[model samples]
Target chain A: MEDRFEVSILLDFYGTLLTDKQIDIMNMYFNEDLSLGEIAEINETSRQAIHDSIKRCYKQLKNHEDKLKLKEKYLNKKTEKENLMKELSKVESIDNDLLEYIDKKLELIINI
Target chain B: MEDRFEVSILLDFYGTLLTDKQIDIMNMYFNEDLSLGEIAEINETSRQAIHDSIKRCYKQLKNHEDKLKLKEKYLNKKTEKENLMKELSKVESIDNDLLEYIDKKLELIINI
Candidate 1:
């Protein structure tokens, strides 16, 4: 479950690097959790073809992740932020203003 | 000056997406601050060819930046961290541990 979510996150980051068709297929397969047969039927193609496309798109996305490691960086940043927030929780009552600022900044990071 | 630095930052993020030759040429030209003639001499190619390669690599890097925006994400993260640090400075005496943790995390992000 988490692995598929990771793939979807990669698709969000690097989807534009792929072709429009590839992006659509990935969204259907990964995000929509559609079977290859369903995607093939919708695109009027063979299931084999959809399978091949998904495989290729997955390879491409993985290559991007390997080369750039943007996903890894993102995960690291998220962890760091979480740790910082946790540490801040230890000092909550004493520094309410700083606590509020960090909270808002975390939200900003999520949206960005 | 900042523009070239920005390009170098983009290269750091997307340089691996390029071919080995393209990455080498970009590093020489952008990071080493080499002229086309200098890179041409090192690569044993004509200056015009080197220029063309640099232009193409630049376009490729820009396209990657446009698509993934890892640089923009990094900058935004930096700004957010800086702002948080600034806010923390106001409450330095109150929460030393959180301030120290954030300082370490910012350095970690930069290295990552």
Candidate 2:
């Protein structure tokens, strides 16, 4: 489950960098939790081909992540935004209404 | 000048997807305003080779921008954030201090 989740996150960041076939296979394998044999059936390829394609997809995705670190930077920014929200919540002297407004805006920015 | 600026902005969003040689050549040609002959001299390549590389780099960058629209989306977001800041500025009856604080925060978010 953990491995699948990590791959999904990587796909989110670097999926566009992949070929359409690699992306489709990855979506089935990681997102849909499809087995290699099932993917082979759907892709109309042999199990060995499906296996190799998935392996290559993983390698390419990991290589992109390693070179760009887009996923890592994204996660770091998420953490930073969360921390900022916490600190904003802790501010005691600001008007409560303004703080609430700011909190709402912060959530929007982080989601972006 | 306008074309060069547009290319530089495109490079900013999609440059990591490019080879290091492409990036270096682009930086020399665009950012440093180097002529093809100057770049060729520095790279120890023929001027025609430098020219061809730059042309290919432009095509590749344009292709990436066309597929992803990252630069267009980035420009749109910048405009949206600026519009948002304007709207935030026009709100009446809020504490001017709180408004100033919010403006600063908004700037930070857009710059991110």
The model with the greatest lDDT is 1
Q: Name the runs in model 1 displaced over 4 angstroms.
A: A1-3, A92-104, B1-3, B91-101
Candidate 2 error regions (>4 Å): A91-112, B91-112
lDDT of 1 by residue, B1-77 (tens): 22679778988888788999998988888888989899999999899999898888888888888887778877887
Top candidate (DockQ) = 1
Task: Return the top candidate by TM-score.
Answer: 1
DockQ of each: 0.55, 0.27
Error of 1 at B39 (Å): 1.9
TM-score per candidate, in order? 0.83, 0.79
Tens digit of lDDT per residue, candidate 2, span A28-99?
988998898999999899999988887888888788778656567567656665665566566565457756
Q: Over the full model, what C-alpha lDDT does candidate 1 score relative to the true structure?
A: 0.80
Candidate 1 to native Cα RMSD, angstroms = 3.1
- Tens digits of per-residue lDDT, candidate 1, A1-112, equal 2368888988977888999999998888888889888999999999999989888888898988898887787788678777767777776455676677767777676446
Q: lDDT of model 1 at residue B22?
A: 93
Interface RMSD of 1: 2.6
Write candidate 2's Cα lDDT for B1-112 as tens digits. Answer: 2389989998887788799989999999999999989999999989999988988889988887775565675666566656655655665644567566656665565445
